[model samples]
Target: MTQRRTPSGQGPARRPGRTSRPTQRVRVRDTSSTRVEPRVARQARPVAAKRTAAQKGATKRTVAPRPRAITGRATVVIAVLVALVLAYTYPLRVYLAQESQIAKMKQAQDIQRRLIAEKADEVALWSDEEYVVAQARERFYYVRPGETPLIVLNDPAGAARDAGHAPAAPAADRWYDTLWSSVQAADSEPRN
Candidate 1:
């Protein structure tokens, strides 16, 4: 290794072919001129000793003696809170269920009341002689005096020979007429 020193004598030496390395300029304390007090020297302790003292103090404070009464009280408080929540849950659920049932029953009662009102109105209408006569004429074809009832025919030839006597009426009209005739006939029957 070759050492090439600077002519000024302050900077470090540089190698022949390589770049010069940077040197750190440290400021040294002039201890020969400064005066030190004995009290300040006694007060200063090493950093490791200071840290150990702080850690010992923290450990002493953290490990406090807790009584059994405080721990038992905390456990009782938690249990009571849980019991209160559980006790309220059942009654709350039952109340909600009953409320829903009441709503449904109210709706059903409203429907029933509406039906009863409609039936009562129908009964009132039936009690009127005009309404009854109109119903009998339209439904059963019960013609009054001097009123000719004309029966319109569809496939009269097919229907003519089918019945041994007269031409049969359309099956639909006959069914309704027969039912109405039976009801009227029953109402006219004398009760012994």
Candidate 2:
């Protein structure tokens, strides 16, 4: 609302104005300097003088603007992906390993069940009178009461061949083992 008087005591009421350039507005801003830069100071700036010819010949100047700054979306996406993978990696590995272990345990349980069933069948046979008599005759070469014992010739070489490699036993343990065998034979007998 106020017309700033120049240092030479003139205001905007005069005809001398900054209408020389069309686009470039040279409004006299309220700077700290009392006067505009002198001609001597302008000539001292050689860099500005060298651009006078280029400014006159060019209608448009190609100015490369600065690249846009990075958005935070890419950083957020990478962080989320990293966190998701880190959160699931341990649990995924543990689940897979446990699944594998469970499969092995199932297989082992099936084998143990089959072996236990076979042992149960053997125990059932041990309670039969015929099985008890057969085992005593074959494994122990036992004879019935008042019967003469006759050795069979089948696989006679197998017993003598392995005899040298057989472990030695104390005579006291042999007597105890014979007593245990007689008890087992009595126990293996069928109930009336």
C-alpha RMSD in Å of predicted model 2 compared with the true structure: 22.8
Query: Residue by residue across 1-192, what tens digits does model 1's lDDT show?
Result: 534445443323443565644576977788798986665454554864776577643322223355576587799999999999999999999999999999999999999999999999999999999999999988998998999998767986677678655765656667788899999999999999
Residue clash pairs of candidate 2 = none
Q: List the residue pairs that clash in candidate 1.
A: none
RMSD to true structure for each model, in Å: 24.7, 22.8
In candidate 2, stretches whose alpha carbon ends up further than 4 angstroms from where it belongs are 1-60, 63-71, 152-192
lDDT for 184 (candidate 1): 100
- Which ten-residue region of model 2 has the weakest summed lDDT? 13-22
Give the poorly placed runs of model 1, Cα more than 4 Å off.
1-74, 153-192
State TM-scores per candidate: 0.44, 0.44
lDDT of 2 at 79: 93
Model 2: what TM-score? 0.44
Across residues 72-145, which tens digit of lDDT does each residue of candidate 2 receive?
88778889999999999999999999999999999999999999999999999999999999999999999889
